[model samples]
Target: MSEPTPQTPGTARDDRLAGKVAIVTGGGQGVGRGISLGLAESGAAVLLVGRTLHKLESVAEEIRAAGGTAECLAVDIITDGAPEAIIAAAVERLGGVDILVNNANMAMPLPLSDYPDDAFRTAFEGGPRVTFSLMKLARPELAKRGGGTIINLVTSAAVRWDAANYGVYSAVKEAIRALTRAAAYEWAAEGTRALNVAPHAHSPGLDWWMENNPEEAAAFVAGIPAGRVGDPLVDVGRPVAWLCSAEASYLSGATIPLDGGQSRWG
Candidate 1:
């Protein structure tokens, strides 16, 4: 286990979550898409939740094309009862829950004072609130499965940098990280597991940034240790699969950083 190498096979879709059902919030695009597909690759019945029905459908089709079972749920995860609806859909369609990836986060970067209350609410909807609500819903269901995994996908930049303007969003995500650890400790005896995957990969957020500022995007990539952005299937994909797999059975409540060593320099 200490061998500095992955025990699983390469990038081909594997059956790690063979009998599992997973719900991925904001599964339409970006980091959420990466994690959703990863779980599907592991053979989990994926529930892709997002505001964009078309995008969610596209992802679902891809999963089906790959011969994996998937379904699309379109709704703002921040909406009241959205999480509950998602959980219900999984139960009705796939039977039960085995894993959950909280991948929905409003990435509206703004100063603390300038950040509107509604924006803060939107951000919190995905950051900590959704996580809390989902866990509350999944707790009882996980017991029936004998155990399960709840993964929170936070951002590494929030912890490693001092972005004065980004503090509001960071605070919400940091709360999720804290919750991840707390849940890990409290749910240990209940056969429940939780963890945070803080990724600094080139996701839809980065693409938005680059599209707005080509210079800044180029500079950012140039500064990376690997001198390149992360690949969802290879970089972000593998770690997510591992965490959702039995191979990482002993891990829980870990705040893992998969940022191509971005946090290492600091």
Candidate 2:
């Protein structure tokens, strides 16, 4: 993919997210990277969190070069203390957290009966558990800022259930979908909104699948009404950026499908 186009200094479209701080897990690459850039471009100071220091730093540098504020932290979200540490870093580096994007996840495709127990456990630990922990940790920080938004990156497989060998992965994502809705409803009074974004984008995971199962990948792409898989930044990042902005203040407890009409769920 091409490098993200840099925005000119002092030419930001609008500072809807000005003065806000955001934490984007898995912000080193693919959809996470896109969201981080989109948020930064919209005038929010961003903290990019992921396991790879180099990848995170690269993305942070890109944001900085684009005249956006950003910082990078390398840490595994599944670790016991990671959530708290991420929130702390955001607070110390960017002032405070006004948006949280729980986009870090493991994509494992294994048949249900053949799936290893360890891998299944790892899936849940990495997906729902870590997301829950992060949301819980960031709640007070968001509240401190009067209000904020949380966007959980999910998959179309979780809702459609058409793909084989995705049982475990889909289940874990479904759990996150449930948690997102509950948080949206319960946290409404606290001014914190929660939602989900289901995107179909070109990423390393999709590349892997395409290389291993060319026929399946082709069929999947054929199903998209948009005639092509989405660009991570142009397609997925824009909607997520809007979700984190004040314009979407009234949107909560919903899942916005970014799959270009591939999935019927609204």
Candidate 3:
């Protein structure tokens, strides 16, 4: 199969979310970084919230360099009052929140039987707990904006049959999926849409796998009917950008798989 086309800088730029303010957790690296860039490129002032100040600054700088607005909020979202602080920062720094992207999560790869209590706690707090907190805190602001979009970054593993060692990971992700859908229904009257995106894109984790296990990585890539991993910015990010826009107003409480046909093919 031929390679997926590479996207050049500013090639697909548009003002789809212009004048809007978006809060993206873990916006410093991986898929979060790409989503931040995509949102900025589409004309939203992004508040990049994460633990690493430098990484957040770096992504924020890239947005500024591209003539997009962004701000860095370095904090551990798992901490108490962090959600409140994040919402406050977005309002103070970038105006009210019109979009909230719950994209940060940490789940160790372990079988359900072997998963320790500490590891499980870490995963639960970081994923579903934080996501729930942020969504609850941002609801009033999102509603105040007349309408808003909440994009929760879930995992395709939640739906895959052969979870194997991904048992604990999938459990937390599934919780996020449930929270998103529940919010979608509960907030329907308020014009706030909540949805999930399960993305299979190139990231540090995938790079580590490819470098350490080339054969396995190759077979994994081959399994994807698209013949390659999805691009973080173009494949995953662009669609997310569109999803947060008025064009997707009709969409809510749905999990969109950005896996290059891997979900269906499997």
Candidate 4:
């Protein structure tokens, strides 16, 4: 055999993830879509999992059109056995997973006294519950790979008290932060990195919020430092790319705020 070929620095970029895969929950829309595409643009095959097949397929189509590898799976992650089905499907299709983006969040932002019991139940069931399940499912795969990244998509409300109107949503997201820190202690030794990304609301989700409650839209828009709402790709996507990349290899159990200085509001 010829002498072993010397590897060049740049030539190995694609293979940086040749055998790796990523599963992005709620990747059909909003920040999750941004994360999924960002990860794929970096050379990893991605599984976009969410409740809406149409949205998932749209994101998947974009990824494929852009020459990236992606597949869509629609699963109601809040149902008793749904998380298991979603994770199992991704694991089967991808063979093994190297990254997990816990962006699937459900929330009902209502005042304490006016909060709907069903809404609270949904948020509790969907947010922290699903995060826990996905992490548990991804653990062995991450261990097999010897290194992996888990970024939990969080909202700024989890950090700032008096955040406009998200009481119950913030609580579960806070629980998610605590959950990630707890997991960091358990899995850091296994070459796993768990982190939280607190991003300001941006994307079609915001649009829906605005449409549903247009009266609050202007007030919300006025507070942003950018003087306008941010774009999910540029605002939310790039930061997620960094957090998921080897650039963040040294970070674990960390919470990063991508809030455009809005977190400065008291």
Candidate 5:
């Protein structure tokens, strides 16, 4: 584990997660990268898992440069035996898993009527199926450590009324949400916590969309009450760090929206 230090003026990083081990899926880029950085900054050893070797290595390099311990494992989470392999890697490498971040999700946005079977299968296999598998495999390891935290990356579109062509995507995310809640309840006695996060943060995908369609992007930003897109590291990651720490020991199962008030969920 890395020792905490001052990250910026007036902000002191603490050793709240000192000696802990966290495994993050899709941890090389975007929100996943943000969370990985966050966990590392908070003094946890992070395992960065994703499909691209270079991307995972890049993030791992960043963590190492910042005096944090991190390892990279390149593998598609949707593949067979991936969940088992990930758990084994985490235990064999980082000692054990104290936190699991299921951040990799595959989905094709299409209307229910227009959605194809193969697309749906891809979404199903990549999202909730893999998430469930990882959670199932990580439970015993988590329990062995007296309990752990699981964070599932979800989407606000899952609860939106005008989801439109997001039926397939929303369904997959919603299923993950359900799994989070169920795990929160089922694992409570064991001290394991599970929660979902719906973050609307800037990413490479959003950057491309904004660059290609400024008007639409501007309109979308305008619709957000915060008046701007959230920073993946600050808005999404730091808060998630809190959630994974003792600070949020009492919080679990609920979906925390990091959209800067864009969502109106009760």
Candidate 6:
């Protein structure tokens, strides 16, 4: 595996993840992008996977510009072949995987009564199923390194269920939360740790909501005790990076709230 590039003058390098290899799905944008950059900054070779080739390329370029190593793969995670392909690519290019961030999610805001059956299936496919597939596929690679960390991006809505049109989304995310806990126990002997991170950040999806419904957006921000939405990288990504490091090796099966105290469940 390639080592992380040396940091430039006046730049500090946190080598907690030195020589580690990570795969971040949906890494082309929003929370995934933040986590991808954060892991790279911490000294991990990252494979950024997303459906949009251009977006993945852009994020990869940003990582390269920062003197960090990153490669982009554009693939739809909902496909049957995607998880295996992703793991194969990471192992081929970066050597082995030490971290897996399942951040790719598909959500459609609609009440249960009105939600289409196909949309509901797609939501589950994009959410928990994709996460499960990736984790299983990456298991051997992680075990090869003695052990590794898996972070699945969940949401506060999974617990709160307060949002009017998010029933399907919440259900799917909650399923992933359960899977994360189960994986933590089942994969422990193999040296893999599984955890969930529920974040409330200013993501691109939220940005779109803010643009379409200003009143709801204002109310959402006002509800947070932090008095503002969290930055994707500053608030969410750093914590995720820490979770993947040796300092947090003892942690597993926990759903950490990265939502500025907005989530009722920790």
TM-score pick, better of 1 and 4:
1
lDDT of each: 0.79, 0.86, 0.90, 0.77, 0.88, 0.86
Off by over 4 Å in 4: 1-18, 161-164, 211-216, 264-266
Clashes of each: 0, 0, 0, 0, 0, 0
RMSD vs true structure, all candidates: 4.7, 3.2, 1.8, 8.8, 4.9, 5.8
- Report the lDDT tens digits of candidate 5 across residue range 1-266: 11123223212266789989999999989999988888888899999999999999998988888888999899988878999999999999999999999999789677899988988899999999999999999999999999999999999887676889888998999999999999999999998999999999878888898889988888788877777787767778788889999989999999999997888676
TM-score of each: 0.91, 0.92, 0.96, 0.87, 0.94, 0.93
**Total residue pair clashes for candidate 1:** 0
What is the C-alpha lDDT profile of model 3 across 1-266, one tens digit per residue?
Answer: 24567665463289999999999998998899989999998999999999999999999899999899999999999898999999999999888999999989888778889999998999999999999999999999999989799999988776676779998998899899999999999998999999999999878887787879988888788988888888889888788999999999999999999998888422
Error of 5 at 16 (Å): 1.0
Instruction: Return the TM-score for candidate 5, rounded to 2 decimals.
Output: 0.94
Candidate 1 lDDT over residue span 1-266, tens digit each: 01122233233357878989988887888777777777787788888888999999998887888778898888877778888998898888889888888888875668778988888877777678888998889888887898798899876658555687778767888899889999899987888889988776557767788779877777776766766666665567567878978889899988888876776422
Model 4 per-residue lDDT tens digits across residues 6-78: 2221211233444568898889887888777667766778899888899999988887887778888888888
Q: Which has the greatest lDDT? A: 3
TM-score of model 4 relative to the true fold? Answer: 0.87
* 1-266: candidate 2 lDDT, tens digit per residue: 12244322232455788899999999999899888877887888999999999999998988888788999899988888988899999999889999999999975878899988888888899999999999998999999989899999888886574668778878988899999999999889999999999988778877787779877877877887776777777788766888888789889999999987998774
RMSD to the native, candidate 3?
1.8
Q: Write the per-residue lDDT of candidate 6 for residues 25-56, one digit (tens) a residue.
A: 99998889888888887889999999999999
Query: For residue 184, what is the lDDT in candidate 1?
Result: 92
